[model samples]
Target: MAGMAAKMILGNKLNSVKGELGNLAGGEGEGNDKDEEEAALIEEARQQQEEERKARHAKMEAEREVERQRIREKYGLKKKVAEEAGMPEPDDAGRITRKKKTPAEMQQALQQQEDEEEGFMDTVKGFVAPFAEKLGLDLFK
Candidate 1:
């Protein structure tokens, strides 16, 4: 009796395996066609949603750009121009153009910056001198 039960279980398993192999070999009849149709429909729906998202994004970007231009105009701000040929064009004649600094002007600016830095360092040394003396660090020295 036990042997007969085991044989029955093995036969059922073998039959199921054969069925799976037949399906893998393209013998699934009408069910495979229905599955393929469903997959194609799903793919089509995904593509449509992607296209709609891209369109919506583009529309939002255009609206944002328009709003930015409106804000700039309200604030009397010039529209930013991209540099063409390594030079930016002025939006209007009334806009002030910056002149290149002469060698003398550049030298003066550098000297002024150095003096300011030295002054800052002197101020810091004055503030830290007492602490340095207490700790015997002699930082300035």
Candidate 2:
């Protein structure tokens, strides 16, 4: 009879442990669902804040541009066109994209610069040659 009672007590304890485990498992699923919902809401709020910040920045930039134009007009300063100034225009993101020079264009510019330098050197040589000749210096050699 004592053995029978011990077996019944053990069985009762096991059933209670299983019930607690089941409750814990179910509670964990609910907690995960709540966490996921909160995370989604936070992400959505962050995106909205980012959009608002961008809009505010754009508005301020526009106002600043208007003020700059007004000041330029007051001073009678003409805004040079990008092309005329040989400067690259700003792209949609407000970044200046440099114009890549073609190989032919680069060669031509280099040649023109060299020609100008050679002309100046020739004038200097003409001025110094007579002095060097008188001194027997032969500076060119």
Candidate 3:
């Protein structure tokens, strides 16, 4: 009879542990549901942001169109047909009137700018060097 009582106590303890494990697994399912809900909310927020951006872009476009129309009206500029403009209808016919700088010229300009900046920096550094030295600060190092 004592042996039977021991077996019954062990069985009851095992069933209680199994029930706890099942509850833990069920809690994981609830966590997954919460994660899904959070993901959905994030997606919704992204959609709302996209809609707001589009609305802002449309508003800006409308405002720009209105401004352009007002400028045209103020200047008394009439829309001319392609033939009335007395130019080639296609934009490819436009010529580059101004000459572009060559690579060597561009490099020379950049070097000149760098030299000027270096000279200015040197002047500032020289003025600050004595103060820095007095403070025992080796700024150059």
Backbone clashes, candidate 1: 0
Residues 35-112 of candidate 1: C-alpha lDDT, one tens digit per residue:
999999999999999999999999999999999999998999877665555666654657577665658899999999
**What digit string (tens of lDDT, one per residue) describes model 2 on residues 1-141?**
999999899999999999899888787789789999999999999999999999999999999989989999999987757555788554546547856676889999999999999999999999999999999998887
User: Candidate 2 has which clashing residue pairs, if any?
Assistant: none
lDDT of each: 0.89, 0.89, 0.87
> Model 3: clashing residue pairs?
none
- Every model: Cα RMSD to truth: 15.3, 20.6, 16.1
The TM-score, computed over Cα atoms with residue i paired to residue i, of candidate 2 is 0.42
Q: After superposition, how far is residue 79 of candidate 1 from its true place, in Å?
A: 2.9
Candidate 3 ranges beyond 4 A from true positions: 1-26, 78-91, 95-141
lDDT string for model 3 (87-120, tens) is 6443544666744565889999999999999999
